[model samples]
Target: MKKDNKCVDINVSANVGECAYSRGSTPIADEGDAVIRVPVELAVLNIRTNLAAKIKFPEPVLEIKDIKKRVQIVQCKLLLPGVAAGTDPFVEGSYHLFIKGYVRKNIQYASPCYNSGVCVNSEMRSLTTDVPFECVVEIAEDDFDRTPQLPFQNARAEFDFFRQQDLGHGYPEKDHFLSSDLSQFHQDSSQFYNQMPYCELISSRITEWDEALDRKPFHNSANWQEGTFETISEKMFLQFTVKVLQNQQVRVTAL
Candidate 1:
């Protein structure tokens, strides 16, 4: 090492061609811990479900121009509120996942004109509404990336005492005996907690149909005028896949 920065070069003869490869044992380090704590993937679920709804219009809608729809997922969960922790409940030999969400619908339509029957004279109106929904799907014997991990608890230990009294006259001749306590016995049962399972949404798909069942043309009006609809019915076929997850410990190893 030099304090003052300076460059020095040494002259030597070297070969420029490629060197032959050599075989040797790969180096391996001793592991300090056997397992690592991390979020692990549990199972993948492909769910298919449908929902139907009938909605009423705010005002008189003469004709429908356009409608735009989008899905907004509110929550995805694997655990229910009343279910016990660290336990998975089965219904009909299957696990159930509950999904909650809403669909944002934007309706662009023309309102009927009382004084004029012509569609061009009618006023165009826009309505935005959210249709909420909830559904449950059953999952049984599903495929997993690996064996799903179960909840773990620590080893519990308790201490007890025995009744001890020394008999000086009896102990001088022979060994003294002690008796165990028999009045009360207790073993603590609430020494550990569980890591609950969770859910992650992968993707969602929807096929929807919106129809105006009561749409009718104005009285004594030509075909150019728009029809009115006071009520609308919608059918949505939703499809999505989710991943159930939990915290797990995996062993560290090298191939």
Candidate 2:
């Protein structure tokens, strides 16, 4: 079959599924019950095997030509200092964000063969396993653009000093000393609960480098120049972009 080098195939048109659209912001009161969203930056910790790790290959390989790597997060928990609950008042302070998880790795390597001293790998082998990791990252208060809304407003408190009354039952207080009555004094406190903070994973990126720690001759061949590796050392650089969020009652300015 003869095909022209500059033959036209298809022409695609631009998609205009959405036309002009806009939403008018409604005027809100100075204070109201509402939920606001907050976003922040997040960092991922590095992982390294550090020592020789055993590998049980389905079939022994003469040489590891290449290794493919992947990462998976089985668990992710964020720990903070003075953590606020849904019913706990918000505390303003910079704190650490603790993250814990395991990396799920599927390693595929090229199984090599020797043909007259020329090493060639025609078959690829794979292994799937997990490696656990954990870390603590600092999150400053100004890291995120959106400010956390407070559950309660600062209101002026009104109070008055109590008058001192003569207490016959009490000591003379160093010969006629005046003291305020304590039995009738009372105190009260008002606390408001705020929304608990949480996190959402936005994106993840991982890079890996692996090497064979030890290698031995294949089947102890008399003249074989190829060998197989039973131990591998793995290292990875992982990164993640996550959003720290919390829904809280906030006052809105009419737009």
Candidate 3:
């Protein structure tokens, strides 16, 4: 069967954390209990990878074939519960989110040499992985609605790749995708506990109550929709040990 040119499979992962803030903009004078809710929208803005070290080679290793590297972002999402208050007149609670990362790579061979002594050649190719996420920020109350500022709203999640296995050895020098980092892979997979149902907020207001005047749940969800972020903080070394051949003959001995 011929391969489908329009189909691609993607994997997703999650990250969760606990965050809380005090209820209301100011302290109250009445001893009676009251509740104030703050609403906000959450979304995944970007994904990034940091290479630990550059792939090194001797100046004469000109024909660097079977050279490949890969990176990607498989999943990104957020889950936060609505804030509520009781007798003590305070809001104390936490929430969690998910952010998964992945990588894909390809191999390329240097062109044949014609007339020249041994020389050094370096090549660099760039690629990116992007994931979109959306969620509602709901806070119900007696009157008025406020959208709280999202903490770490545009912060980047860092992924480590130093201990990853080499993807170049298993198969013949060729092109394919590999989930190279397993430890971190599982770490991201185990983040979601989902105690509360994720209410996909209606794109528009659902109630016409007077307090609902400013209840645009995800009015700005598209603000960061086109943004991309870095996931790995450092670059990993992608070294290759190659031999320079000349005249279809071995010019230097193998290491």
Best by TM-score: 1
Query: Order of all candidates by lDDT, from best down to worst?
Result: 1, 2, 3
The lDDT per prediction is 0.66, 0.53, 0.29
Off by over 4 Å in 1: 1-34, 79-94, 113-115, 152-191
Report the C-alpha displacement of residue 166, candidate 1, in angstroms. Answer: 26
In model 1, the Cα lDDT at residue 44 comes to 85
Q: Considering only N, C-alpha and C atoms within 3 Å, which residue pairs clash in candidate 1?
A: 62-227
lDDT of 2 by residue, 98-147 (tens): 66665666767666544444444457777777766676666566663444
Identify the superior model by lDDT, candidate 1 or candidate 3.
1
lDDT of 3 by residue, 1-255 (tens): 987785544433444668788864433322334433222222212222233312222222223244343433343333434332222222333334343433333424333223222332344333333223222222233211211222211223456564523457665555545554555532222222212212222221111111111112222333322211222222333221111111111123234
- Where does candidate 3 stray beyond 4 Å? 1-41, 47-49, 53-71, 77-96, 111-255
How large is the C-alpha RMSD of every model relative to the true structure?
A: 16.9, 21.3, 33.5
List where candidate 2 sits over 4 angstroms from the true fold.
1-59, 64-68, 80-90, 110-123, 147-194, 219-225, 251-255
Query: Which number leads on lDDT?
Result: 1
Candidate 1 C-alpha lDDT tens digits along 122-212:
6888889888888876556445553443334444455567886566774564555587666656465543355576777788788988887
Residue 24, model 3: lDDT of 48
